[model samples]
Target: MVQINFAQKQVNAKIVYYGPGMSGKTTNLEVIHQRAPEPNRGDLTSISTDGDRTLFFDFMPLDLGTVAGMRTCFQVYTVPGQVYYNSTRKLVLQGVDGVIFVADSSPDMMEENLESLRNLQENLSEYGRSSEEIPLVIQYNKRDIPGALPIEVLEEKLNQRGAPAFEAIANTGQGVFPTLKALAAAVLDSLHKSSGSSVPASAPAAQPVAAPQAATAQPSAPAPAAAPAPQRQTISMSQTGFHKAPSLPLQGAAAPSEAQAPDKGARPPQNAATTPGPQALGGLQLKGGSEGDGGGLRMAQPATPPAPEQPPTQPSLSMAVPPQPPAAAPAPTQAPPATATATAKPQTPPANRPATPGSMMRPDGGSPPPRRAPASKSFPSKVQEAHATPKGGKPKSAALTVLIVVASIGLGAALGSFVLQIL
Candidate 1:
């Protein structure tokens, strides 16, 4: 049986080892407990099963790390193979999700293996579970013994259920882990399939609720819920992974625009490449073409989106780079961004060089020198003007008054000379 604890987010399952006495059932659990990592396994426990002993332990296998969103864990229990412990075997097998039937490979013990096999099927039937229904695996242990029975002979009699079988020498820990891993995988696989088959059976019960809701005020709200009316966390299992979902409290679908994101996968390239001008760099490569194509591609992506902000700048850029026409088209488009860059750098005007060739030029090819001459003086002249002025505005006003005073003195000297000559 499988128990899911929602609070702990853990799935618990049980697997029992069944076989004849001295068939290596106890050795299997001992080998796994000793070899398994300390944190991965719990304490090895012993139970007194009427004069004989039984062993069991808990383990977390990383190969089956998580199912759905919950951790998967299992307890391995071994039953005494002695025929007298029939009641104890039934008690152990009560809720078993899976079984690993370990058979002794010695030629002398073949009869004991067959008896244990019959006993296992009889005990399973008492609990109302079919031997064919539950997950089962067969392991032929003691393969390293001299003149051991052949694995083919063991499988011919023991594997009537068509379960996966393995040969092991459990005392030396040769095949212990593989046997346990195979059994854990089978258990989870059965749990998933059983859960899936039951989902549709409960769906019809939800269908009749729609008729009563339709007679109420909110018919449309409950209409869609009738579809797959019994909702649960779907369990999905494969060689790649296992997912066992549970009754989640609440969940929401993505917005319609976000849900349609994958449909737009063919969108960005169409929009980005439209302005790059027909693969100016062909897939066929030359030494120079690779760099030019890569650079032009890198430059065009950023330039294209912002081109909408200032549509006028591209023509000036195209006109400015006429000398390099054979170069790819995207390089010229990149220059449109230099309008702000050109204005900022004009303070440190170049003597004859254009301040960024693309931004300073016009489409008509006129005023090449006129625009370049004045834009170069970006900063130094402002300090020279502040040093020349005495309170800046007062210096201009004082010069006009000094010119008027000098004119009055010249007129008075001319009148004095005329009076002296008359006397």
Candidate 2:
């Protein structure tokens, strides 16, 4: 697992070194701890038996510089290699981001190497991780010992996945840094792929510090040459094979020839070879000529000057009639005058007309047609009146008033009887 702390701007990952007992897993870590600078490495903690065999695990934290704005730290651990300690090995493997399988190259230890490798695969499977998916590397240790198996034999037995393999003699610290560097690069690549960030293959890989003279006392086959510094490069893996991603140019920098090549899917630019020149007017070619020459093109001569202006000519005036308004249509034919009685009689309401309920008669000597109460107001007002009325026909307020009057009358009668009795 890669733990990212945004507030701290830190990224921490775990890499485990796993192998059988006496495979120099501990030695590999010791070499790294000794070579790393004081600022870049942390105290190495180990739990081992009296014989110096690792009991639980060995932990060393290494600071690989910043990547994508986060300071990257790797907690490197070495699991106990004894067969009986499989449980402890599995515990150390938990949350591992990468694995370094250190195998003994001695001819006699071949079986032990095979067993350890199988154990690694099984444990990784238990965690729902696979050697194929995780960043993995193989280091064939004990290369300095006589009668050790050749690189080819080790590959045949242990390199089933074809992961990058390194030859190292951990006792002398030979091949130590290269192995670490390659594994770190692969781990970073895996992280970038998983995170969907652009993998920076061009970022320089860290170089290992030289080990103390005592650490390199023995010489393995002249330590394999350190891999050359990386160029502007990117690495990609596919089902077919590992392919190099085209190097992308830095911002504002010219791209390399390969990157500048047009993509097969893109359309070519129109007029890519030439820029548009100034336009010509009136069929004139303006190249290499003075501005006044009009590019040496022929022009129509100027026309003769116009005649001088003439004075105004007066016109004779005559009387002119103004337009008349449109004639009006003949007045509409008048209807015959209504006969007028000598005395006009006042209009009166018909005796058969019936007055509407709930309407008052008008006082114009004639009863206007009775008006009906508005239907909308009539229903709501009737509901309000019913709610306001008590069981009696009058409203509650009227009933209260009548009660007050009755009380007053009873009191007055009582007072009058008292007065009469007094008299």
What TM-score against the true fold does each predicted structure earn?
Answer: 0.44, 0.48
Q: What Cα-based lDDT does every candidate model obtain?
A: 0.46, 0.51
Lowest-sum lDDT 10-residue window in model 1: 281-290
State which candidate has the highest lDDT.
2
Model 2: C-alpha RMSD to truth?
45.6
How do the residues 1-423 of candidate 1 rate in per-residue lDDT, one tens digit apiece?
Answer: 887788888888888889987676765765564445455665444332211133222122322346678877787787866676678678889789888888887888889999999998899999998887876667777665556787656756766544555565554344455466556655655555555565443222211111122111111111221321121111111110211111110123122122111211101111221112212211111010011111111111111222112211111112244554454543223343333211111111123322222212111111111111111111112222323434435866777778777877777887889889998
> How does model 2 score by TM-score?
0.48
Q: Candidate 2 has which clashing residue pairs, if any? A: none
Return the top candidate by TM-score: 2
For residues 1-423, write the lDDT of model 2, one tens digit per residue.
788899999999898898888887876786576456666776565555423456678787899777669998999999989998899899999999888888887788899999999999999999998777877767877654556687767777887665656665454344555566666766665666544357444532311111112211121111223332322111111110111112111222121222111111011111211111111011111111112221111111112221112111111112233444444312211111121101111111122223222111111111111111000000011222323433444677788999999999999999999999999
lDDT of 1 at 45: 42
